[model samples]
Target chain A: MVHSIDQYVDVVGAPVVEQLRRLGERLKDIRVVHVNSTREGGGVAEILYWMVPLMNDLGLKASWEVIHGDEGFFGVTKSIHNGLQGYPVQLKKKDWDHYEEINLKNREHLLPVLEEADIVVIHDPQPAALLQMIPNRRGIWIWRAHIDVSRPHHQVWKSLKQYVQDYDASIFSLTSFAQILPHEQFIIAPSIDPLSEKNMPLNKRYVNEIAKAYNLDRSRPLIVQISRFDRFKDPLGVIEAYRITRKVIPIQLVLAGGGATDDPEGKEILDEVYKAAGDDPDIHVLLLPPDAHRQINALQRLADIVIQKSIREGFGLTVTEGLWKGKPVIGGDVGGIRLQVISHYTGYLVNSPEGAAHRIRYLLHHRAKMREMGKTAKEFARENFLLTRQIREYLTLYLYLLKDRGRSVFV
Target chain B: MDMDTVPFYIKDCTLLIKMSGFSPAFDIRDLRERIAQCSPSVIYHHYFENLLAPTFDYPDFRNDFAVWVKRQLDDDVLAERLGMIEPYRFDSLEDLRTHTLDIIDERLSELHFITAVPPGHEFYFQEAITVVFETGHVMNNPGEMFKIMPQLTSSSIYYHFLEARRRTPDLTDDFSLWLENFGSEWEPLIRDLRSIDFIFYSLPELKEELLYIMQQYEVKE
Candidate 1:
């Protein structure tokens, strides 16, 4: 269990503070439960680790629970994840049996909690199957899909639909991600905490200390991309971009992040990145512990440039975090990344390492343009990517649900 | 508190205000049963016309429902607010357990046992069950609170999500498949909403004139 700390509280800002105070006054002692896969690694888990406690602090009884899944279950779920990301990977029928078996196992154990809570929220694909097996469960179940599903592969979509259809409702980060479900759907975009160590303004001393501790040169202009070392993240492509940009201006690159429990290919991708970075002194590949939030914050602050360059992305929280810290990020032009990295304004959305390298070179040479881009990027996040706005939408959604509950039927 | 009394109907105007902005005390439940009583579904029949069926069909659904709901608040300036407010305070989890005990102690000290359910009202709830006594009839309700699951208000994210599903989808399936699908999968939720010992009491259909409004829109099943 990740420690529920107040690390991300300040970025929630004054608007959320005022709104939550009012929300708490209206909602005293209301019980809320959030269930998602993994306590570390993924953005959903990271957000909830902070959000659940903050919700509780705002005068609601809120708690977080991590769902259990084994290697085979993850292997199956990863396929579904890939499939949802528009990848076609066929699996056997027993793969599904394993998925449901884990879900049923969890359902048997989670019955009491599910039955008792005022609201039982299930996150993502791994635990979504738990809904079908909920016997005598009473509370509302909302499926919070943090993925960008504008172009999901069909078979995986078809396979997951069985478990998904059982939910009271499903929420997508963007309107394009929603599918045909037998429940109410809402378009609630994901958010990053402006005050978290990953996004907050850190002291120059702290940034330098982390740099010194990691043997990173403070004088050298640093270009960093913080993301899990996964194939789709295109970490290798980022290395190529860094290498290309280094031909003219010798800059340091940091590719840092850890593997999610559900993502099996992360470690292999990490090893592959190391080979590409072999004997390159400027390239620093760090497999960071999941708790290294402040480390990332400092890196983004110190870095002259940041890049995502993922082939497929759900709303990239790292992109939001980088932009929030006033750094111009060049991210892949796909999925939720498109919502954040508005090409030329917030950051460049590139199709290739060549494209990414070209932007990096120009940004490095032109600090004034980079600074202007960073300001726009941070302002964009403040206007859109903050948690308070997401929470307000949720509160409004809740009110809509309650009022619609006992309304007279049209027919 | 006559059941038939139209307490606070706004005959001409419509108000879609938030509870926090308007009445801070009311739970802002769409279903009168949800916030009104512990077993508000006791008046399961009350929610039949009020809660079931497609919401998209009723353009005046929120306004019509608000007429009934606005009265359930006691914000003084607003509608009727039910549920006792004078309970113990447990501001946070650090003191929640201890505060719960204080509430228990206070309840013991101020014990006044009066039945919340009225005499013979059990028969009314009992009759409410048989409207969907057959499996076939219940499928028509789809994502409505009574048919979807127990304990969801229309305003809850869960309820809206279900509402989204109820909205028209360009489904690739046939009518035969949808009909043969008795949706026995949702039986438990329906069973929970309608009392287990529910009697077959049908609610009075109030908006027969507005019923045709639903045919204009095609909501997915």
Candidate 2:
């Protein structure tokens, strides 16, 4: 479903919505194009699903474009993705060539729209090579790196840096993820759509039905961690935490996620997670389809305590989603999780499975503190991690780049 | 009191923070060196622009340096000393930087070993690009503030009230400066605005404080 800026007025107040409209007016009719690898699945696609429509609603001419690739191309890009996340993967020259060749193939179809646009934002490494490909572009080009590339593999970063260095600007989700690029690098954290099926409020009946279908016992407390089955997400660690917690308290664990087309490593990780779960009835390792948003939403709503537990993360939108559903998140103390989960406030940040298990037990034992933290978590997500604030920052960046680069204040 | 014809053009701002290209500091000595070498904008952002950034609404300390000291280094005494340095009281950001380094130096002198955090907890230097724009809401008179106070976004509150201290010539809030044109009858409200200990309050808390003051004055009017 398409969303308008006005729909968010009830979630965020009228003043916030009105502020977006005013910012929108300043850049009315400016053509903005966003290019990424996949049109569905993953956080990038989910963000674009709401962002493009809302930008149009706010008066900017915005569009989203996706680059299609075969499995071999995706495999190569996945290696680059893993390597950028500090995983040791050697991407050869042929791998880099195949990556660019696929982008070059898509360049023919995308060049016209990309060249004439007022601003073109290339998301992640898949389409990052497109910048150097479109040499005659007449607009400000920005590369938005959504992953943690702070301690990337040297070979992969050196190759990727060449593709991104000439852009007018770059954007990272966190300051730590930024590299020593020659151009200006801005920090814009990703946010979730509160009105989307994934985060929108569901009726109690529907939530209960989802719970019943999943065979989750209503009597026992549930701990849900929803993320892609990647080693960085550490599904095995979540199970370990659950096992440790179950020894002290009876709780159910749901490790649910869907696969994206661009992520080639998910299947192997999923198999590993299933083996680690090992005949445990309470541990539900679900490989959900791409469109199972409401089911994910229901699972989060059913959770007494939400766990991300990612060893490495890119803003951890699942944590935001859980917090939006009024469940406190126990996230790993790495990457963007540190930004969202505050100890003794929203949720605790843990370094190990033992720490996570300890916090899970503590939260379950102290129901009142859990309720209070859940309340604070929801309001915290409302104030900081919603889509409106993200859009406002994007618009602000556009205004800053287009109008004046040196001025402290735009007006 | 006569109403001033000059309308207050209410504006709002959002900050787009970026890396200052400085290396992350893992220890107090490294932090002090970075503070001395980093640009003034970096100092200004950590000290002043932190309120508008995405963070906990009610942080224990007011600034990022102190928060890092308190949370990562686990040193309450140094955190308190660094937290007590008011950025607004300093004549310039350079002076603020100097005072910050002095506090760090004093703490370093007291410690037998350098206080260092673990790998992931290192302090990354950052700065922001603040984009300010007209909200298109104009206040015609001082009495209208009673109605407009609650409706203001936190960014609008920051732009007009807190950020105004640095921008205006007299180092006063935009509200107080605008109300000054209406004569001495609004002095009580101006005094009330001035009386706010803004250093400790977050944007939302500051907004609530402003709203409470406006509500009290509105009743009197």
Candidate 3:
């Protein structure tokens, strides 16, 4: 499943693909390593799945590495993750010690590759301590924070900042999500691979088969909110919206997501969602496996109006996936969701369940407006939120960091 | 047809935006104060970079400050005044900053209270690093450009047509500046390109307009 840069010529133009080749030419044979916590089941993993191959395709020597952690280690990292996203969690000295101990163990095998690489990008907090481990490394290190840390818990950030403070640079998904660090903070928004199983177009027969398997009635309209069962995603709020909308409009709601290996709080959140959705035939609360990408794609394609009711989000790739499938999305008015969903253009941004219900009913009633918004949404994703664009920016960043940091325009 | 004319080398750019290291502005008075002290790159980013940024709607106002004024402050009169100050019309970013502050200052004097937004709605200052590279496509003549124009990406169109004004000594697009070397025959097409009200159109729409003007000139020739 290796992807060539030329494969994207049809989606984006040849000039766009040619631009990537030229940028890739400038940094040919530079060893770039990306390290993260999980190898699958999250946005970071999905990005690396295509990024490593694409970077290699463009003639750069690129590789991806993952750090393995047990349940206790993951539990601590999950607390750190939640704490970074403005959640209040008490993390003691033992928690930080365990986090450092795991990274220290992984550093034994990774130091050889990491020390000699031209650039090493540490994704998220799981492997952030690796920078402090490699004291004499001969490369530019960048910390890519994929979550909102605008208002992080003081204790967590105070501890975590020590590990990331010495990096050459850092990247955040949004400006608001960035914290006041001592290095240059670049803002590069995350994008989805349109040709992946999660976002690629599916045939009507396959979509219908998925619908039939899930016992979803195709006659009525469906509102689907696909995300992990986390408190920040607000799965219960989506159920509340469904109940509010179901009173007048006959609709089915699907709240489906897969559990990432590093997430220890997902099971607890899923149990709460199940209890909230009790005795409701139309409300399908599915706990999918990590590899259920095609099924998730089918579910999104089956939906009339897609919803991503997140109280907080990294970049809301589910909202992008829904938009790519040509459906109007109703996202929460927070984080990256505000960037994607325009009130009257693509879809509505709601702050409460009542607001979500109102928009759902309005879009369902006006079919023509829904069609117009869907058309606009697809083209919007094509222009801005595609993986090709993200790759181009990353290549450009490499060139900037390697060549010259003072110049605003690089020729 | 002229042998002495230089070829047009097509180039494209992609923007990498970064925070300007300024604290977020919570109100109009704070915005004016920051505008007075912030760097020119920060001013240029808020005014010109919106065209390249990802947005769902065709915004009524062109710049981020005006949009914030309209949406957050809910003052269309002030928004209208701020949006009307075109960045490209100024000789320098310093002049643009002065003009921008004047409008805000005028409005401030007439207001009874300071206009402010809620915590989450504050305006954050940002700037961009534009990476420019040659696309390796060259046109020997305007006819060749006419043939290759539609095949170019929107970024290419932006680089040649809009962003050129910032870098070129003549403060005109690359196409028109290059056309000037071909003598008086290409004068009409150069005038058409220069006369385009490019501030209102999106990149795609702007490309269409460029193509339309080229097609009209092609038929005449």
Per-residue CA lDDT of model 2 for B154-204, tens digit only, reads 999998988888878878899999988887999999999998998988788
lDDT per residue for candidate 1 within A13-102, as digits (tens), equals 333345345545455576778888898887998788667866776667888888788898888988888888888789789999999899
Using TM-score, rank the candidates from best to worst.
3, 2, 1
List candidate 1 stretches off by more than 4 Å. A1-15, A405-411, B1-221
What order do candidates take by lDDT, descending? 2, 3, 1
Residue-level lDDT tens digits of model 2 in A60-87: 9999999999898999989998899999
DockQ for all candidate structures vs. native: 0.01, 0.71, 0.71
1 against 3, candidate with superior lDDT: 3
> How does candidate 2 score on lDDT?
0.91
On the 0 to 100 scale, the lDDT of residue B135 in model 1 is 12
Candidate 3 Cα outliers beyond 4 Å, as residue runs = B1-5
What is the alpha-carbon lDDT for the whole of candidate 1? 0.60
Q: Which CAPRI quality tier does the interface of model 1 achieve?
A: incorrect
TM-score for each model = 0.63, 0.98, 0.98
User: Chain A of candidate 1 scores what in TM-score?
Assistant: 0.93
**lDDT tens digits, residue span A1-411, model 3:** 447988888887777788889889888999999999998888999999999999999999999999988898999999999999889999999989999999999999999999999999999999999999998899999999999888899999999999999999999998888889899899989998888889877899999999999999999999999998999999999999999999999999999999999999999999999999998999999999999999999999999999998888888989989888889999998888888888888999999999999999999999999999999999989888898889988987888888777546666
- The CA lDDT at B30 in model 2 is 90
